[model samples]
Each structure stands twice: as C-alpha cells, then as structure tokens.
Target: MLDKDATEFDGACHCGAVRFHVRLSEGLHSARRCTCSLCRMRGAVAVTARLGDLHMLAGQEMLTLYQFNTGTAKHYFCSRCGIYTHHQRRSDPSQYGVNTACLEGVSPFDFEDVPVTDGVNHPSDGNGQKGDGIIGVLRFQSVGC
Candidate 1:
C-alpha cells in the first residue's frame, strides 16, 4: 500500500532498451511469487504497484506484451533482452506485479524468503479461498559470502 512517503525507483530492462520509474505499493515488503503455469516457468519475484504508479521513461516501443489463459494479465518484457519487466495482475486489474529484478540495484536473490501465491487455483478462476491467497513461502539459504 503506497503512502504519502512512498519512495520512487528507476528501473530498466536487461539490455537497457526499456526504462521506467515506479513507486511500489508496499516497498520491497510486497515481494512475492506466484504458482501459475506461466509464473512457474518465468520464475520471477514481483512487487505490487498501482496502475498509476508506473511511468515509462523510455523505449516503450521496445517492450513486448504477452498474455495467456484468460488474457486478463498483461505481461510486458523487453524485446531486445527478453526480460520480464512487469504485468498487469489478473486477480487485481487495478494493479501491476512489477518484476523486482528490473529495479536498479535490486535482485530477486536479495529476498531471503518470498510468499508464494496460489495462482494455480486463482480465486478469479472460481477456485480457492479469497484474501491473502498465500500458499507457501520460498526461502533462499546462502552457503558462503
């Protein structure tokens, strides 16, 4: 949930062809993963952003869109580098699930653990329980520095 004190971040695609600015809905605490078919294959950690919070800075034409299943979620990636940048969430059309990796100085590995949503049985698909929707958590244990 973005408050008046929300901090803005600059982000770009791996190839630097696409750039954007965003204000997360809950800072980095919003980090999460999904268990849907597409999400499972992409394996990206996402943070929430309201539709009005994401502002494309440059190379909008270099971005590609991909959709599947219900096609309600609009996934955007950099065409030059094949990097997933963000997606309009299917369960919540008013928000986008921004790729944490796209943010400058950020990496998915930076999170020690992330909540995994039950996207496989999404509530929008008329299955599973409403609210939270968390099915599990993913933890990363580093061996050495």
Candidate 2:
C-alpha cells in the first residue's frame, strides 16, 4: 500500500535554469508514464501534485509553456535547457504531473511498478479504452485524473 502521506521534495532542470519544490504526498504512489503524442517522445515518468503543491523557487522567467491538441493540458519546460519540468494535467487541471526523474533524491524505479496510460484514447477525449492492448494500463486500470 502507498504511504499516503505528504513530504517536501525539491528538483530542477538539466541546466538548473528552473527550480521548484513539490510535496510528495503520495510518495510516487501515483507515478506514471503517458503516451500522448508529446509524452511518447519525451518519455518521462511522472508523479502527481496539487496545483498548490508546486512552488516555483526560481527561474520562473525561464520556464516555457506549450499547449496542443485540445489545449487543456499545459506542458511546462525549462526554456533555457529544454528539459520538461511538469504539466498541468488535462486529465486533472487541479493537479500537475511533475517529472519523476527530476525529483532530487528519488528514482522512477523506487516506486513499485510504475504504470503507463493511453493518452491516445484518453477518457477526456470521450473514448478511453482502459488499457485495451497497452502494456502498463493493466497496472493502472484507468487513465485516472
């Protein structure tokens, strides 16, 4: 079972141009991989945080935002170094999926069986197939918000 508790964590981009602090309330229990057109390319494992759980400690000016498709999910990255930092989940606007590999002392493998979701058939798009034939979807069950 997950710890289901909150703790402070810190992280930054490759060039350290962007830095931020996030509270890991679920301790990567909600960690996952996404296969949206962009996520499939970026290939980063991510964990969840409430909007307030993230605080830009530095380099806010150096952060860039990219929106595509429906434009609901906003992807943020370090403008200076082009490292994806986090994204405002289209699945859940109130929560951000901070990059798991970017966390200060945590590894994506530290969590048991990280799951991947099928963004290509997202429920948000009105026809999600809850794993269908995807690999990691069996573990996650649904592309949850």
Root-mean-square deviation per candidate:
3.1, 6.3
Model 1's number of clashes is 1
Q: Which stretches of candidate 2 lie over 4 Å from their true place?
A: 1-6, 109-112, 128-145
| Per-candidate count of clashing residue pairs (backbone under 3 Å) | 1, 0
TM-score of each prediction: 0.93, 0.83
* Top candidate when judged by TM-score against the true structure: 1
lDDT (tens digit, per residue) of candidate 1 on 57-90: 9999998999999999999989999999999999
lDDT (Cα, tens digit) per residue for candidate 2, span 84-131? 999999988999999977778776555656677888888777784664
lDDT of 2 at 48: 87
lDDT of 1: 0.90
**Which structure among the candidates has the greatest lDDT?**
1
